[model samples]
Target: MSLLDEVKNELAAITDDSSLAKQAQVSTMLRFGGGIQLVKNVPVVFAKLTNRSSAAWLKSSIMEIWGYDVELRKASSTLATGETMEYDLVAVTREGKRLALQCGLLDQRSHEITGIAPAHIQGNIAQVKAAWRGAFLAKGRLSDPGKSSMMEIVCPSVDSVNDLIMAARRLGVTAKPHRVNSSVRVRITDPDVIERMLILMGAHTTAREWSGKRVEGETRGKANRLANFDDANMRRSAKAAVEASQKVRHAFEVLGEDIPENLRAAGQLRLDHGDASLEELGRLADPPITKDAIAGRIRRLLQLATKVEKQRAANAEKN
Candidate 1:
């Protein structure tokens, strides 16, 4: 299942007080999907929602909360995959000149609904969690943990988006608001914050699953980085050993028994143990010398090799 579906299913499994759940459901719908519209010159209050199940839940909650049996219907559209997807538009009617006035969608100066405003969002953690859950149910999308950390909720009403930001802060999740063309988005990016939100939304199992995947991905990344570092180090050491062997062979061919014993020992150790690190070569020295001491001997051997090559070139020219 998609991460968004997993979160919604997990939320569906949560059991909470009936009244609080209804309040939260109403709050979410109003902010994200609820609208005041004119139908046949009659005022109609409706929630145009995407998820059919969530729309059904909203319809039921509206009946229980306000004694209204709203009409529910499918608004279908063709997808890019040529699959049909239905949007549930739950609408209710009441006698009023303006639909916004009838649905309490007007500014607070004219209308205010209990349990749906920002003031109602404070002082109760359970109620606040439910409210955010409600808003998320309307328009939430969570990215897969295996890919990235992102959780977002979109609301058509700017006031509702503000309500969401406050409610999230009350739950200790830092949510930022931004405008996306006609809609506003409350986005969260921190993995820790996203996990906390899942837990608050009553998706404990999904949160745990996401955490496990995040940990495993991080562990695998570190292992790959370490392996690459070791491989690069080995290649560099092997290259240095090859160059040291060539210098040592030149020193011996020209100096023979006259070669300094210290230089000769360092060169022979490197030529025999081409894959060994400089530290390991130091340990293999007859006197068990330090890496710096072995390195100086190799330097001297290179210098002697260069002089021997120069002398041979001079002799051949004279001949």
Candidate 2:
């Protein structure tokens, strides 16, 4: 099944369950698979599963099933000397790599806060610092000479992601936001750890939905062409050319006069010579003019024809 389907199935399983139990299940799953390490002396289960916890659980469950080792950990320290903070989840891979996952649930009460709220801002900073500490510490302890560890922060909403990036700079952690799939999956490499944690906490639910296929080549190609073409300009040019042609014809009709010397000569030359361009018309004229000059004259004549047609329409309306 697809990642989305799996998430749907899991969500359905939890929908009927108690909120407290669901939170514990999610937190435990994140911990067991070594996906996240609980902060020193910090409590794992919060008082109740708020909307944030629900979102966290759903997102974590999808990641767990998708083969990523996910975790939910807290942060131990902060820039404020005595202040300590915790993150919703700290997912890590089997290779000891880590990703900081933060869930921002929109409050139904306040439509103003659609995604990440300003309240969770400080906690996100602490998470970044924790990830950097984990990455470097893991690198230092690595017995092998090659392959240094790295960490990333994953935020569900665009606002949270942007905020975390700025926060990471202040904390001196080189962190980037993890891009989640449309089904709201924050990918990690350690699914087993996350899964085991979930199972231990009784949050192990099956997934129901799947991700959709990407756009096909033919559709993509057409889109690319349209994106590059200057449609507005082409339409304008075509309209101008047509208008010019009509104006020249109208002048001849209105005056009941023979075609102008220039136009008659040009037409004769066109008939005599097959497939001649505007440049050839300019060359054939007594007073040589640029191709652009000839085109301008033609355009004016067409415009005159258009005016005449409009006049004819108005006259019919009056009658």
Candidate 3:
């Protein structure tokens, strides 16, 4: 199963305060998942989901908590890729006075906070958290922590997104919303915020797992950066050593025994330890010297070598 499904399954297993769960579940489904339509002149309320676990949870929760039986239907369609996808649709009729009590719960919630406004919901933090949990089970999705830090919910209504933003603010999480195609998407990018939200949604295990992945990914990224830096420094040092050695050879070819003692020492050290850092090369100097001091001598030798090469070019042109 996908990570999202895993989280949903974890949430589905949580059974406490059936009343609160039902309220939150209904509100969430209404905002993010459910639809109202006429089936043979009778108003029908339904929640359609791609994941069987969520649909089963919704079906079982509605029956177990509210004592209302809902009709469960499965429909399938083939994609352009020739893969067939199955959808679960759970529906209840408005016709039966048998479901009147359940329908009343939905209607009452719809009238009071139909727009997804957390502020409009009566009660304390538990209610707010429950609402968020239900909404997530309905429409929430998370990117793998190893890839990116992203958690988002797609809501069919602007009011629902607004409600989500307000609810997150109450939980001390900063959430933003934007339009995606025909829907509004509320997204959270902070790992800490996502973890907190997941816990609020009753998916504590998933939250901990996500946090561990995030830590591992960050540690790997930092190690890669440090290794690249060391490699770049080594390349720079090797290039400098090669150039110094070439200059030293040219000085000897031109000046022969007249080459300066300091330049000769610098050249020999570089040739012997081409991969060594400047500080390490300096330590091997006779009477040991500072890296800056050795570097100065190397610079002078290159300058002299350049002068000799220019003079030879001028002489060749004259000849």
Candidate 4:
């Protein structure tokens, strides 16, 4: 079975064992699979396994696989806001390097209904950020000699990486971006980086998810409204409306001063046919004017018209 399958099987076995839960809130052990392994209990669940799970399992497993001594500690505290928080597992590698892992699962069904998949991912990132900050502040007590400490965020989906980066930015932290397989990942080596990555990621992910759902809903609504109209009539009405506006603007420019031949032709077409667009104007011209060229000429003409109107107003004021 795959690593994911193994994790699921182990989680099922552990959850079913009431003895394991009573002995320790969390458990850590090594299991042999495709290779030697270390498995730690991760409690957060969304719809899918997240970065926290990967980090928790990978860190512990790798340490054992490499024959490094590992220690797991439980840390919990209440924030100034009176919010209670807990750390699932804090592992110290034999090299004395400290690593913190937070795991969460996002349910696909809820994501589909609430359309907050991104927000859910951001929440996971927030927990990781909190754990990192908590660790850094306690570094005086947590740090060990000859060991550099770092935090790793693991999520099942790569979609959350951008959110994590946003969180780092908000906290004024410099976060290093990395990848864990196909998933998007960010690494925090600095305390400030950890703070910022978490905040930015959380905020951005929330905003992006909200915006995406809003846009999709708006688009669908618009399509429904337009569905009632006859396509040919809508197209004609749209074309006519555009041509009428363009013709008036073009006429003002033509009356102002010397106009180029190509521009003159375009203006005439707009004035004569109330349904012609820039594309149609382009097709009619000799050595046809490109759509961009037509647009540029129109813009310049409007600017000139504005200047002429301004001059006329100034002259009238003087009189």
Q: Per model, state how many residue pairs clash.
A: 0, 27, 0, 26
TM-score of each: 0.75, 0.30, 0.85, 0.26
- Model 2's lDDT to the true fold? 0.39
Instruction: Kindly list the per-residue Cα lDDT of model 1 for residues 62-113, writing each as its tens digit.
Output: 7766676678898877977999877787777763224344334554464534
Q: Over 4 Å off in model 4, which ranges?
A: 1-250, 253-257
Rank the candidate models, highest TM-score first.
3, 1, 2, 4
Tens digit of per-residue lDDT, candidate 4, span 1-319:
3322232223322222222121111111110001111344332211111223423543444344344454444456687799876543434333321111211112333221111123322444444343232212121011111124344544223433455455445455665667755644456665333324323323333223334444566677678668766676778778765865675565565465566665566566556655666777667667787767766666666566666678889999999
Error of 4 at 94 (Å): 77
Worst 10 residues of 3 by lDDT: 96-105
Tens-digit lDDT track of model 2 for 89-194: 3433332222223222223342323233343334443343322222221111111111222223333346544654454456543334455354121222233332
Q: Which ten residues in a row have the lowest lDDT in candidate 2?
A: 137-146
For candidate 1, the 10 contiguous residues with the lowest summed lDDT are 95-104
Per-residue C-alpha lDDT of model 3 across residues 37-127, encoded as one tens digit per residue: 5578776667777777778877887777666778779977797799997878877774333342243323433343345533324446776
List lDDT for all candidates, in order. 0.74, 0.39, 0.74, 0.40
Query: After aligning candidate 2 to the native by TM-score, how far in Å is the CA of 232 from where it should be?
Result: 3.5
